[model samples]
Target chain A: MFNEKIVNPNELRHWEGRIELYWIYTSGEAGDRFFKALKDEEKFIAAKCKKCGKVYFPPRMYCEFDFSETEYVEVSGEGSVRAFTVARLDKDEKPLEKPEIYAIIDMDGTDGCMVHLLGEVEPEDVYIGMKVKPVLKERGEREGKITDILYFKPS
Target chain B: MSVGKKDISCPPEAPGTPLKDSDIKEKKVTYVEDHPDMRYAWTAGQAISRFLNELKEGKLIATKCNKCRRILFPPRIFCELCYKPIDDWVYVQDTGTVQTFSISYIDPDARPLKEPIIVAVIAVDGASKNMAFMHVLGEVEPEDVYIGMRVKAVWKPEEEREGSVTDIKYWKPMEK
Candidate 1:
């Protein structure tokens, strides 16, 4: 404080400026296909087990009970919101830039669930079993991903 | 080859420079001093484990329950029904059928290993349904492996034998 930083090392710029950054995220399968159908072709896919006759929402390869292979199935993006919650943190448990509504949409007539973002609702109004449909992302603006629909709202 | 023998002499290795990658492996080694040691010996089930152990010596093994009169493979150490301890051993062929398996592109630690390996669960001829062992598979494409395909052990050279499962190298399709 007494030396006044010695004229700041005699440089015009004293700090590093901002720069854009990017990264490639490779989601194993469910995440990969969810966005693929949503953005690229506007589709939703799920895995169905042929032996057990039960389907999984997140999708899996083997049946934990008997260790059998799971059959893949394409789901019609139509469904209703079974349960919803507000997610304020990222997967890393860090505060996200913007809070989003996460809903477990019980797919239409299927014994399964799909967790996605919910839009156009206040905090107090999201009920346990509300009817909702997938608001698909426009084809022109789509990129084959979960972000395509933007968020699930009232059908 | 001797089992766990420590009498052999060894030569000194030449010292080398540091390696590029120095990742450490984590193998949990634990011991219980306060509690009594849980001992398990194949002697009671001589008809099973004995023969399986002798396979390293190029022999097969099996056992029959005196009470039930059933030929048990992999050497059943006890009568599963009556709960009485078993005490016989017999021999069986190394030949077995492949149950199911995955071509692991990743290693045990979830890392990309040197090359893709075929890890399989093979059901031995004398073993019961779903009875299998985890072993390396080879000599065919990953897609060629089927649930019921026959496979046999391809042993390593005799001089390289260490009386361990690794001595069998990897299993390959048996000649039809």
Candidate 2:
């Protein structure tokens, strides 16, 4: 008994498959508070350390520096761009219809920064240190998620 | 307001407003959902490639290891038991005997289904004893399925066939 090996490359086969699954993400305590504040009040909350008095934007329950309890304080959701980049391609490497500007925004009166999309201004005009404010969705449309703030635009 | 110099003591309880799942669903809290589309491909090596191709043509194929005299279904190029290359490709009967079976009331994700499905390990005829493969069973009640029950392949129509294991739609109990 003898077996013949498949010699032609065209005769070889491969099976196609996919990761047919999804993920559910839950916002923890700090994130829940921060986003709820943004959604309900259109304001931002920072966690101020009871021990060291460091104010953390995107509020946390415990201070990162000294591991002390923190208290929430409200602030206007305004910031300045610390750094920026222009993205001509999306995550899949496909070219976008319009290039998007992304920036690290240093929040006013806090020691933290957030990376978010910048809109309503030309990418070439987006300088570092430019003052910007969050443009939130209509109150009725807000879903308490980060996208509730549509983007940051120069104020 | 600045804290006084003497005002530093570890609070007995941590400061966080615990939220329940109801809070999230009721729009009392915030969350995000993300879905990414990822895909993959697996190469069916020499033996199984031929096996799948034969299935697309509405046939069952197997490989025989002359050294161990064992017939391998869902054919493999090499025999694990004899540690040698299989000697020949052989066509096996589309009929088989059920080795074991289960009635599943839940889907793959563990969600309950309105109707149950019967799945079985079937030892294909013309293959070595115990050379069985897993497949779903149809046209039979869960109570009627038992070990050693004879079954036959139910294939999809020819034009609809893809060179995959699913080319055979399922295995059904054979007529007496």
Best by lDDT: 2
Return the clash pairs for model 2, or none: none
Question: Considering only chain B, what TM-score does candidate 1 achieve?
Answer: 0.62
Q: Tens digits of per-residue lDDT for model 1 on B31-142?
A: 1122334432222222333443465686546655667666565555566865675545555567788888888889889999677899888877775565567788888788
Candidate 2 regions off by >4 Å? A1-12, A16-20, B1-21, B35-39, B45-176
Model 1 Cα shift for residue A143 (angstroms): 74
Judging by DockQ against the true structure, name the best candidate: 2
Q: What is residue A113's positional error in candidate 2, in angstroms?
A: 0.5
Give the range of the ten consecutive residues with the poorest summed lDDT in model 1 chain A.
Answer: A1-10
| Model 2 CA lDDT for position A68 | 85
* Model 2 Cα lDDT, one tens digit per residue, A53-130: 899988988886666888999878899999999999999999999999999999999988999999999999999999
Per-residue lDDT for A14-127 in model 1, tens only?
223344443333444445555555566666666676666677655665445444566767777668877778888988999977677899889874677778888778657788
The TM-score of candidate 1 is: 0.36
Give the runs in model 1 whose Cα sits over 4 Å from its true position: A1-155, B1-53, B128-130
